[model samples]
Target: MVDRKKSPKKTRNLEESRKEILEAAFWEIFTRSFQGVSVDDIVGKTSLTKGAFYHQFPTKLDLGYALVDEVIKPMTYSRWIDPLKEYENPIEGILAQLKNLIGKAKPSELRYGCPLNNLVQEMAPVDKGFKERLENALNYWIDGMEKELKRAKEGGYLKKDVNTRQAAHFVVMAHEGFYGMLKALDDPKAFDALYDSLKRYFATIRS
Candidate 1:
């Protein structure tokens, strides 16, 4: 016998269960490399059974890909890409965004560094799927910065000679390098030097 009321509630419960599994899997993969973590590790963190886990994520690779597409991509876009639209001055916008990131950063965030970068470093070399997906996200970031810098150039904020493509590449590479170095050194003073170096480099492109 089909109970109509029970069906909707069961569906909600199923979705909620799947969300929990994904969230758990996200953190597990975030802290532990894709190759380092196991299906058992993810399942152990949740109350769900193996069948329930398999129902939501048929395989670990599927879950990893979902985490990259659904979890990481949206996050990178919102934090790193969206805010750039707000500033008339690309340099100011970039610096303001960096300051905001530095302000909100916690010890765990510092320790873990950037998730996109971490995954690219860990999984990109070994897995074709991971490499392509990660590169897509990275390209999105680079393209966004390049677009903003070109806008700035058109607005006469930057020198005509500036190469937006190379400048955009330098911005992302510097930001990632700063975070990785900070995490490695475990010193707050490292941020001051990083910021100073970035500002000095950015100075060269300004009109």
Candidate 2:
């Protein structure tokens, strides 16, 4: 007879573990504001152990920063920035992206609100690190929009007097505000009304 000992379970690789933690934290933070969810709450959602979590993210704050850099930044680029490249008129691109987002949005998303906006409201004021990271993400979005708007202006798709920088900022503000209102009202009709109003606004800026 051989002495029998239990075999230790194989652990996930570092990148895989890190990704799991970030994904779990993202959903938790998205639904329940970042301040509302504890580290345990995030870890509980993943199969990884506390040690595994710490190995990937030294602190909860670090995890939040990583979440913004890794998940939110890429998401913003993919959803808002990349789509604008396809249209000569940035206004048309912006409207098309908004329509696609509204068409594909889930009830939970409408209820929880935009993830980047949620973090900005919750963490930006109190935490310096969060403020910097969130500000950078917002600037990335604004810069991308500004670049496209500039292109449109050069191509004569936008009004001669249109200020691309200010217009880009306004678009970001309105886009974030749209989700905030939806989250507050929990009304689909509000989305349709707001969308139509945005279309009218876009028309005013076009050549």
Candidate 3:
């Protein structure tokens, strides 16, 4: 029976719809390269029609930029900065935050390299827009790491000989390395090894 008055369940606004499409694009780009995906790949994840897609994102390039702006950049900021900003002991703070992620991470998630990293590696080289956006995201990562390292230095947790920039880069780089290792082996133990090794490294640098 058709209702006389159709209920307005309501739909997302432009910004909200844009965010949804970008998130779908993030997942699609993670599983495949940017060039490998299409507007259909993104809209497929949503209930909205192609009209909605074009209304929010006129091109894949617009979606790619928004993907980095919303997802990648903030994720990088959180992973590499939040611990440092919130905790007094920079080194242990970083390690503890990582362990917290391990504690909560679903077993299924352990099998993929970070979705953002996957897209960054695959799309950064092939698309100029992606390349710029990826760099913007990575810069947030590097800056966050540098901030933590600076805190460690000031707190006397690191040796004067330690180059903060280098140390920070190493930390972020090693994290990606561990995630890549996890994807290849699908072993939480590999992540365990990484956590343990970083813990030991932090112990050495502790005040």
Candidate 4:
């Protein structure tokens, strides 16, 4: 009789399967709110079966948690955190990253708003687990920004009186608000206005 079991090379690795599910879940949750997308919807987006999904993620909530931790956190770090290290003036780095993101944003991204902000609006209030995980992600971003802003202050790039912590929080809140406005207005012009306004805000804190 022929062997029915899959060969080692053909069998999907745990990490690969988990990553597939996370990527599918990321888009599903990004386009549709986390509460809006179902397990079937997420699985359907992937090549994997429901059994395979369950094997990788015991529960849909578990999958959501993993998505936030693995995908969203890293994305936040890359876009907002890591790039700051490349510039001596964190203010310039912040503005450059924002400009880059705005310049590259697709229509759908503007329409949908930010994924992290979307989840914060959709899931944070209703679910404690989600609220904690999402807040942790936000805090991570805030902490990174705070560190950079502190460095800027020490480097004399920011006003000596500027509170780095508050500045970081404001930057994050303003960033989220910019996306929120874009999502609500569905107009690309709003980005230019917001970008200009953010530039002005940064000017106020400059040394």
Candidate 5:
């Protein structure tokens, strides 16, 4: 018979180790770019040895994909998707979300830009596996915005003729473009202008 107490503790410890490895990999890849960061760099950030790291991730590519699937996807969902649910005004919710993101930004975030956008630009053209996974994450962002916009239109927050598909596409493009420019210029103040532009764009969508 299984010892229920010991078995649950063992499972919890294993899961914790797996999460620790992914957390290490996430920051390493974010700072160095996924292609530039080696497995050794990630292991160096954690207490786990090479063997323990390999036991959890099996290979570098697996760790990268897990970072995309488990860590990054959930972060984006919480930041960009979850708050939109049950919101009375899609435009206000979106604008508030952007402002919240900007409020939390640091100099380092502006310098490195978003990890998702970084991978999309660097790996999409050359790497199929990375491209597919990155695209899935991007689609999740776009689709969530598209859904909220559609709800707003249906509920009379948007103009009767507003095209939600285009609106959603514009939002994703603007955000990605803003982050790319911010990273290239290493200027957090650039968000002020971008925020103003975004506000004007949101104003146009109001009923």
Candidate 6:
């Protein structure tokens, strides 16, 4: 008889458990922006018991931070900022990534919108904790992009007139506005048109 190996399910128990909680937490966030969501929604969605919820998150806010720390933060760097570091032509890489963002955004999401933006719009002004979290995420994104733009400028890829910080502001603001309009209209044509226009803007830079 051949010896059988045990599944490392035992070893992965905590990791798996954490992932489950985070996945449920992410869904809760996506479905319900900060002011409107509850811990019960997350707990009810998971297979684990209510005790499991407590073990992972003492309160819903803790879970919110975890979602940012575990999921959103890494993606912000990888999906938008850090990738530019590797490209021979960083501006093209950046523009391609912007197009990729729209491509990756689900039709439903385009109809409903970005969860983080939703949270910022709904909670930031009145809720200090939420404002801090939203600001942290937003700053991380803007700072990273600005860093890339600075790098591209130093390489003589962009116009001397291109202000990296201002460009970063314009990109983020335009992205938020595009998504907002996309959600309101439930149309990809608007997104495509705006993004194409942005691509043309990129083309106007020094070559």
TM-score of each: 0.87, 0.90, 0.84, 0.92, 0.91, 0.83
Write candidate 4's Cα lDDT for 155-201 as tens digits: 99999999999999999998899889988988878888888988898
Report residue 108 deviation for candidate 5 (angstroms). 2.5
Model 2, residue pairs in steric clash: none
**93-167 in candidate 6: lDDT tens per residue?**
777776778656778767767766777787678767767877888888888888887888888888998888988
lDDT of each model, Cα atoms only?
0.85, 0.88, 0.76, 0.89, 0.85, 0.76
Residue pairs in candidate 1 whose N, alpha carbon or C atoms collide under 3 angstroms: none
- Counting only residues 3 or more apart in sequence or on different chains, how many pairs clash (N, Cα, C under 3 Å) in candidate 4? 0
Q: Residue 82 in candidate 1 has what lDDT?
A: 80
For residue 123, give model 5's deviation from the true position in Å.
Answer: 1.9
Candidate 5 lDDT over residue span 1-207, tens digit each: 978879988988889989999998888888889889898888899888899888888888889888888998778878887898847877777777777785458877678888888888887888888889999998888888899999999989889889998998899888888778888878778888888999888788778
Q: Pick out the ten consecutive residues of candidate 3 with the lowest summed lDDT.
A: 3-12
Candidate 2, residues 1-207: lDDT per residue as tens digits?
643342222233667788889999999999888889999999999998998898888899999999999999889889998989998777788888887896458777688888999999989999999999999999999999999999999999889899989999999998998889988988867888888888888789888
Q: Which candidate achieves the best TM-score against the true structure? A: 4
| lDDT tens readout by residue for model 1, 64-144 | 888888888888778876887888887888888887896357766788778888899998998898898998888888998
Candidate 5: C-alpha RMSD to true structure equals 1.9
lDDT of 6 at 195: 82
Per-residue lDDT tens digits of candidate 3, residues 1-207?
856354333333666777777777877877676778888877899877999999887888887788788877897677767856777678877777677775346668766567667777777778888888777777778888888888878887788778888788788877777778877887776677888888887667555
TM-score of the candidate numbered 3? 0.84
* Model 2 TM-score (2 dp): 0.90
lDDT pick, better of 3 and 5: 5
Q: Locate the minimum summed-lDDT window of 10 residues in model 6.
A: 2-11
